[model samples]
Target: MAAYRVPHRPEVEARARRQTQIARWVGLALIWLLVGVLIFLGERAIPDQHLPWTPLSVVDPIGAATKAKAARTGEDVAACRGVLAKGGLTYVLAEDSANGFCSVRDAIQITGGMAPLLPADAAMTCKQALAVAIWERQIVQPAAFEAFGHAVVGIEHYGAYSCRRIYGQQAGPPSEHASANALDVAGFRLANGEVVWVKSDWDDPGLRGRFLRQVREGACRVFITTLSPDYNAAHADHLHLDMGGKPLCA
Candidate 1:
């Protein structure tokens, strides 16, 4: 009665240790399940355009997934045209042509959307047109209003489809223009009868300069390449925006 103690059992201690580890694993499993459910719900709550897996619609708001979705349109001509139609744009498919390294296929002439393109017949790839439409709606118009308190009435572009190499070089890689994959935006015409020329107003200390810079920055977000006056003398007279070749923003 004075000394009564139970001896420690190795088997019992081992069993207890195993049970603790099992409980820890079970808790971890529960935590992971809860986290997965939360992520699923979050994705469901977001818009389709914001979700990377959804089909792209040109009318969709510009979001993190917008650029990637737009880029994918280049892979399918029909899909790109479908996006344009769904966005309520007026466009006509241009006749397909091929000549040496200069070929234009799956290209379109956008007649109605935000503003008319000057020269009335500037044609570009469907993917390029889609990007232009989105840029005008999301970036250009908003920047125009913020800067000039007027809406853009027309877009003045140098050209879209040109059969020439980069800088018209006699020998080198072909330019985006060769396939109608690029747009040279020379300026914009505002509702107030005012014209903003990149060559003339690019350095203006007033609203014109601000508007141009803002649109250029937005173009960098939407297009794979955005070259402005700041890039080089070659692009000093227009903003060279394209969805071809390497990515660049200068």
Candidate 2:
């Protein structure tokens, strides 16, 4: 009672193997195609701000892609200015200037719209200005209202441009201020005429402290760097926000 068996043919086995391989390839191709179609459809359903591939608009609500999109503006001055204009930010291009390692090019002095940046003449790179606009509209104002039920009227800043190294050191890399790429926010003025100082209100257990911390957290989302009182003594009095160097939040 020997069982019947088919003779093993190397050619037939090889053909079967090739067919299996082909089937696998077809399956993978179909899977990839389906994935791509889903992504395309999803992009249409989602907001442009959330999609990394879409052109960035400063007016767009802050989303997962905002920081990445904002970062790209640093590379293109015209594009950054365009974003500011499209967002309805009133700004004038600053005269280009250079001083040794410090140079201000493609910089702008934002004059109106949103909260007024203190020190009426302060100027910063177009990219930094764009970040400030987005931050004020999307983060600062909203957080202010949510916390104190009052909108922010003005942003009090230490300054924007300075020809100096990091912490004014004689050596090492230049600070973002050297190129007007940073702002030291000292406090905020509310529509109610009350002011919230990072130096004083940061430790309060009330709305002011919450608002300040919330804005700082949100700044970390848009700016490449955010140093608060928690960072070190140098930043204890103001929130140091910048678009230079690596991403850091403290």
Candidate 3:
């Protein structure tokens, strides 16, 4: 018997399913490409900028004196324009003060315009001129001479100004460094080609001791307070020199 039968187009149905699958993969690939392009452009369209640093404040009389000196001379306590001319440096001293620690200047003098004493135009109340004298005779000359077998070629420094508390003390005042009243020296090179760095030679116990002693002895003659690696780790990398009123050494 002849009977009407439903058409079974299985191949057609399978083909349709395959086309749907292909379309989905193509759509996904396009979406991924667009996402990658957007990411690349976003990264290139942005700009960068730098942050600013803050200034330090005065801690003790020495620091106050440094700022005062800077104000008075219209130059910083570590100003080296005049000294630099003689030694070939524009800024021999970097930082000149701290906020919570005490400091003292060295005593000693050499040239007139650049006497060991505070610069003539410094706005400090310190009346002692011997600090510069000590610095010249002991710290500056001896370090350079001993390390090099001749005179010192140059002085390397960390900084002088820092508006913070003393390394150990909880709170006294600000450090003299904060006021630009302190000078932190790192090392010195002698004309004979020797180097006296605080970080390297501060603990040799002999040469380092000799250098520290010389500088400390020099500091006694100049600044009111002197701190060195022998004093503590805080000063292990440099000689802290502060000259404002009296004198003390560590």
* Top lDDT model: 2
The C-alpha RMSD in Å for every predicted model, in order, reads: 4.7, 3.1, 22.3
Compared with the true structure, what per-residue lDDT tens digits does model 3 show for residues 1-250?
9999989999999999999999999999999999989766754653211101112111111222332332232233333233223332112222233223443232122234221222222212122222333255435675656644576555566655455556636676666654555666777666565667888886676865576567766565446677887778777887777654235578
Q: At residue 182, what lDDT does model 2 achieve?
A: 95
lDDT of each: 0.90, 0.90, 0.50
Query: Over the stretch 1-250, how does candidate 1's per-residue lDDT look in tens digits?
Result: 5898798899999999999999999999999999999779977898876777788876676788787788887668888888888888889878999999999987899988768999879889988998999899889998999988999999999999999999999999999999999999999999999999999999999988999999999898789999999999999999999998688999
Off by more than 4 A, model 3? 1-134, 137-139, 146-148, 168-172, 205-208, 245-247
Best of the candidates, TM-score: 2
- TM match of model 3 to true structure: 0.45
Residue 238 C-alpha lDDT in model 1 = 99
RMSD of candidate 3 to the truth, in angstroms, is 22.3
**Worst 10-residue lDDT window, candidate 3:** 48-57
- Model 1: which ten-residue window has the lowest total lDDT? 57-66
Ranking by lDDT: 2, 1, 3
Pairs of colliding residues, candidate 1:
none
Tens-digit lDDT track for model 2 on 85-133? Answer: 8888888878999999999988889987789988778899887888889
lDDT of 1 at 29: 100
